[model samples]
Target: MKTPWAVVVGEVADVKENSPDLPLKQQYYIPDEQEAEMAGSLGSPTDIADNGGYIVLRTAMAPEQMENLLRSTVHSIDPQLPLTQVQSMEHAISDSEAPRRFNTALITSFASIAVLLAILGIYSVIAFSVALRVQEMAIRMALGSQRSGIFRLVVLSGAKLALFGCGIGLAGAVAASRLLRSFLFGVSPFDPLVLTLATISLLLLALVASLLPASRAASVDLTEALRSE
Candidate 1:
């Protein structure tokens, strides 16, 4: 009867290095049944020796079981050799992915907080600026400035501030992105698409922040504003 198995082919040096001080009989393979049956009939221990390779019996075994078997086999063969850096393939794969996942999570969290703070800061600045400019806005209205014009002026001021900040931020990001190259996977730190999207988003947020203030400015009553001053 044929037993199913997985063939684990690695460099001889790697196998020896990973499985030092192990005996052959204690070692087992996750076998391919078809190949094992074809090869098993041709070899005794002496015949297997002339082939410069070893065969493993395919049986029901977990990864841990296979690992233990291989370690024991190596130890049986060479008791003096030390087994070092022994690990399951699954563990190696997980170790490889851990750093990438950590970096992604950290970047995502920082970006979220930065965006939230930017929106809040913009909103507060525009609100305060509009409040301070109420007297000036009333004067403009009294002097025949159109509501639309006042609105445009307020929005333009906010846009100018946004553009200035974004320009500086873009430069800083470009300079800082180089340090993050190791953390980036598929996307470049200096990606044009990312920069363009960020700029557009920040500008849009600035516009939104300024809108309420602009509307308030435009709706200011010349008589009431003048009387209050």
Candidate 2:
């Protein structure tokens, strides 16, 4: 195979035909004569080289019809020739991506559960704080504090904690992204838009979680809350 053959490299092709993660490497396209020479050295005929190769055909026919036609055509040349792994281009791409898709889905499910737990934790902490400060809230309203002020106080308190946690989470996420570089395609590990969106979503949910506690604080019965203390 190393023997020199008088052949010209007609063209050069560059493609990511397999996967984007695959490294760029050289692939030689030698002529039939060179192939035959290599095959002879390996104690095989030139036709062995042609035993496996792809045939792409574009047609208006349905896949089933096209497959039948392809089978008939190939068998016409040699009835014993077998056709295997017959599928459309879309199917081929999907098949190749199946594993990646599964991993993405599994990660997404776990991420969703983690976010839900975070929202619940925020809600519980804010609700507990509101419960403990019920008399303080009642006294403030009894004096001159507006109900709107109490509501804003509670909500803003939760929001501050949420924002702080979000900052730490963002830092952690940026660090963790590098681990997922191999699984990612067509995007950077540190995708700013995605990180921003995730942070915003968590913050919004935290605010929503704070709403119930804020409402209860604002609507406290001044006489009853003060008497209880």
Candidate 3:
């Protein structure tokens, strides 16, 4: 049911291809000449391109040298022809990702700040608990419990809280990551590697935050702790 170019319209075969900048659905592929004819028929200028096209080149030589060679070759063929935006594949990909990189940096900064605040919060909670239990700790030490045991006990408490918090956070993250799918590339929103790394990082930070309070609890002066009660 087409009125354009006089060519046989054969049954279409599905082909799967991916482009980072373009959608994958409802795409057509035709010869350059045929596409030009169709564009002309649609009242568009076929003599000149509105947007420039790009060429992909593979070479064993260095990119800078290849770019120079390409420019010289193009000039030799047509002195009037001008090539703009000549760049290596790496540069092109990086340029395309410039905005994405900025977004990622912003997200990372916010996430870092949030993690810092969480660590501080954990430290505060553990420190307060240690202060309140000073008498109990003094009694335990008097009854032959070692300072190292007190340190271990305090650290284990923090770890248990961290584990519980991480479990809940992971659940929320799995739900929230769906919103981030648009910003991510080449990785799934539910990527196991990323989740594992985040969990491990948070747990380690929690342990670190608990360390100072644990140390203080272990070094508590028995007289001061007993008198404070």
Candidate 4:
């Protein structure tokens, strides 16, 4: 803003980042004394502000006690003067963070459930495939196919499916990045590190799930398998 006749100028402060939740805008700050002086010049000295102000106190006593003292002191001058929302800075900051914290918790809970379901679904599919292919695994053993080879074959099958899922999920996430941006704080919606870590976790779980059935297949008794088949 300019002076009364647009004749004076104000120095700009260094650019600084603001809270993510707050929208971008142009705002200026002036000392309380200068603001009060400006108000007095307007001929409404008692109009000090938009009838709103904050009083901060550093005290050993609890905030509730300090609030009572402040209210009584203000009332002694004018009983009509009001005091409200008398809270410490700590409380104010905590209240501001409450919504963000709750959102994070809720998203985390849903993500965890999704991961669990992915793990169980992959395990079930791989286990069933291994069970149906037991005779084939037995024949491979009978024909001198190495146990390590069979293990790799089974595990790779599950890994393939997990990899496919990761690819689709990543693509969908990138496409919806704009929609997801509001829910993120201090993080990009399409953060590569986050995607990489999630992909790796899914692959590791897939590997573990495949390992159990693969191990069972590798240890098959060829003679008993041939007779049963």
RMSD (Cα, Å) for all candidates, in order, is 11.6, 2.8, 4.3, 4.2
What lDDT score goes with residue 145 in model 4? 95
Residues 1-229, candidate 2, lDDT per residue (tens digit)? Answer: 5653455758687766666567778766665666666556545553554667677888888888999999999999999989998898889888878888999999999989998998899999999999999999999999999999999999999899899999998788777887878779888877889888988988899999999999999999998998994
Of 2 and 4, the candidate ranking higher by lDDT = 2
lDDT of each: 0.76, 0.86, 0.85, 0.81
The predicted structure with the larger TM-score, 1 or 4, is 4
Q: Write the per-residue lDDT of candidate 4 for residues 14-108, one digit (tens) a residue.
A: 44333446665676666666666655545465555467777778999988899888899999989998888989978887787788889889989
Per-residue lDDT tens digits for candidate 3, residues 35-109, read: 676656454563535456667799999988998999999999989888999888788778777887898899999
Clashes of 2: 0
User: What TM-score does each of the candidates earn?
Assistant: 0.59, 0.87, 0.76, 0.77
Where's the lowest-lDDT run of ten residues in candidate 2? Answer: 40-49
lDDT of 1 by residue, 1-229 (tens): 4543455674333233222223334444433444445457554555334323434445567867876887798889988756555665657556767767787799999989987888788878888998998999999988899999999999998898899889999989878887777676557888899899999999998888889988999999888888885
* Reference-based lDDT, residue 116, model 3: 90
Q: How many collisions per candidate? A: 18, 0, 0, 0
lDDT of model number 2:
0.86
Which pairs clash inside model 3?
none
